[model samples]
Target: MHLVPLIECAGKGFPDGFYEFKNCDSFKLLKEAREKQFVSYLNIGATWKPWHLYRSTLPFTPMSSPFHKLYGHLSDPVRIFTISGEFTGHRIPLSEDLLNARMVMEAKLHNLPEQVDRQYSSTSQSTASTTSLINIVDPETKDEVQFNDPDFRNGIVTCAALSLDGHHVALGFGSGVVELADIDHQHTISRFQLDPPNHPVWIEFVHGSHRVAAEDSEGNVTILSHDMTAANLGNLPSGPLPAVTRVSDNGLFIIRVPRNTDSSWYDSLTLVSILGDPHLQHLAPPSSNNFTPTSNPPILASEPSTSSSASIKSDAVLTIPHRRTLGFSPGAHYIGAFDGLSAFTWSTSSGELISSYRVTDFNLWIMNPAVPFTCSYRIPDPVSPRPTLSLTEGEAAHTHYSETHAGHNLDSSWIKCPFYVLLPSEEEWDELTMLDIHSSAAGRTPLFGTNGKRQRLPVSFNGKLEFIIPKEYEPVVFSGAKGLGAWYGDRVPFDPTFLYSPRSSKDGTRILLQGWQTAPIVVDLSQVI
Candidate 1:
């Protein structure tokens, strides 16, 4: 694997005037800025700035000043620039000083509306008015706009998603309410209440459409359209609510329902088509032994089974035990799911399992749409024993051909597919090991001076599979890089933290890695492999 360092900020030491090298626990990349040939990192904390990928660091714009104290807890902070893109929203702390400072700077910089509303927090001093603001700077016009919600002033927002068009945002709150906010006018367009006693567990804006999908803790999936029409997509068979719901870029939705009943062996992963039928259908991974289909168009169940409660046929059902992670290929042609130890890929069109591999500590898997390539080859004369034939063809054909092939020897290649999978190193497994320490300690006898003699768990790359495309296909190859410990120098043992989930840029060209005790590492994929 090839490693290219793009941007590295000090985790322990830094020069004066620079943001203190505190543990960078979280960060997000500004893809909008990236499109403008700039790479910016929004490090969560006092230091929030944009840096140029190729030039000197951009000017640091501090939201906090020494003179004023920002009050109150911040909820979700969202980016409000892109017209049709994700990553437009983020959560920022709710501070009076920060809000007012941002308001003044935005109004002056973007010529926004001048009327600033000051509302006092009931918990704060009566003499002081706490600022509660929701502001975003328009990327196209550089104008700042404020979006206001009564709930923002009182209720706590649990989760939020910004629409691709940047025209709307959907926010799920702890009060069991979901709200759609219009960004241009800065007001709530609509609000829908979920079943009582259950807060929203997940909420997402369906891409390429004006719809939103939200799921509550009660295992109920709610679909909200642009017209404010709300419909329940029906709760899955009585079980634990899905761990998470993901909306593919193509608008298909997937939910991972955990196994709560004794009859089930593993969690059930289901898929739904928001643009078509809204039924929740089970997604089963193909048998590991049956990676390839037996036929061109695999035979499907002849009729829907009456024995099953699902509207879909029994043979159509795909089940994977303990499957938690789910992802759709770029164009929705394939769906990939991973249990803790293995990964499987399924063809969406034929409802057939295409590939399955044992993976060790799978971190990230990305399958871009298959690109088509055409290769033209000259037809050699079968009767000719010319040595020149070696120049055009790498090797001689051994297959016996019918009379029809007597004149033809040329073949044309049609399509090529590429994919990438990232795996974590043994050191990355330290978090898991720490959790197992208690169980191991209970099973072993302690012996003084022999502590260092205990055998360390062996690390294996067994299930960690990497793909190699054939040379005839000439597909784009992605290299993998693991082990960030070497980058820490003497601070290896004290690394202490790592992001549970690494954040990737919108274009998937860059990834942002932040941890509690580590400085943020931004890896540029374009420069790597």
Candidate 2:
């Protein structure tokens, strides 16, 4: 494997810099295997989230089988679920052995009906003490704990969700049961049932608040309030939305509802706020968890002369239109939605919308049927400081529970929600244009620099249709961000480079292309330099 940098300049002069290429040790081996046979198709779950899980199912022959003809007839599809909820992508293989069974589900999509439960047992191993909840540590922070609560010991936990803060988790089971488990406890702290048993597709807990919301199989969304200091509210009157039909992603109180089954869903995200004063219709602040009044007794006072007084109420504040998907900028000021692969930004507080940026062909594309399109965002670094704060605030700040917490700086951080689907573009499709050997446009490319200046690269792709970067952009190989950008477009099918943004602070700086599964041999970038 060769690691070469490209510095190409045309109109002016070649920029003086180094193009670093990081090579993964296993690239060449994996490439040969992929060419020979389809070992497996791996997909990254969430690009920007701390907990990055990669799903891959490989078909392989089993060693043992009862029926002679069935032996070779059946192929087991194994899934590799990597736990990167933390920074480092530490992987643990979840197969029959880890789950103490012969097989796990092949796909991550939980929409499959409840009948699939009977095929697998949640409590198969003899040494297991419990049937459902499995506790695991965050791969990045060894001290952080993660809980995987399987509903009903069944094959599917449809509405399982982890809070943005990684402190709480909620799960809607196959049996129409909804349960909330505290990450700190690693056990179910509260449980409830939706009157009619329906599968819950997804759930989202307010980042820093006690309230948690969930969506059922029938498209109904219900929000529940939890008592502070672990007080049992028992069962409170739940606020339900009748017309949602289906819910995709849920932020503090915001959610995405598809307009219909078709590819073109609503292009706006919904924001629901439960208020303290129901009748006033005016939003009331959620009770603060950290507030503790002094025990000093006060003298009773006579009733005020006023005729009307404040009343307690709960209400829902929603963002006007339904969006395909909603995401918060690194700084909470900007909320975004994707309309047909094009991303639009909005001021969460002022409702002021920003111009849309298109990532369609670059990030979204239609490939062969076998190679389905997968999209996800890269979670920023949690510890890295944000660049600057925004001036305006969205209504979401006033109505969302995450906003009520003192420790959580909801105003400073953003949540990335990525959407991926198979739909044709409205714009005219452009066919691949093969550039001539001496084409001037060949070297006309954007250069990424640490100082934010455009410098000419000393090299180019020579003229290959595409380039393939390494799985993780390692420091030893990549010299600057521009080299990573050039490596991205040059890489043929996919960019193996994984980018990371700081979690709390907002900045545009992202990690570049790291390394590849195969070393550069026949199509090396040495000539351009």
- Full-model lDDT, candidate 2: 0.28
What candidate 2 gets wrong by more than 4 Å, as runs, is 1-155, 228-251, 257-263, 274-326, 339-341, 350-354, 357-361, 364-529
Worst ten-residue run, lDDT, model 2?
A: 502-511
TM-score of each: 0.41, 0.34
Residues 323-388 of candidate 1 have per-residue lDDT tens digits of: 114555444445655433345555443344444555332323222222221211122111111122
Model 2 alpha-carbon miss at residue 437, Å = 26
Q: Write the per-residue lDDT of candidate 2 for residues 1-529, one digit (tens) a residue.
A: 2110100111122234311221442333233222322211112111221111111111111123121122222212221112211211212222222233112332321322222222222424445322222232112121011012222123334434444444444555445565665534334556666655665554556434355666565655566555632212122111122112111123433434332212222232344433332110111111111222122112121121011231111221111112113344433344545322334444444444333333333223211111112322232121212223244334345454443343123433333222222332333123211121211121221111111011111111222222122223211122111212111101211121111111110111111121221011011121122
Where's the lowest-lDDT run of ten residues in candidate 1? 488-497
What RMSD does model 1 have? Answer: 20.6
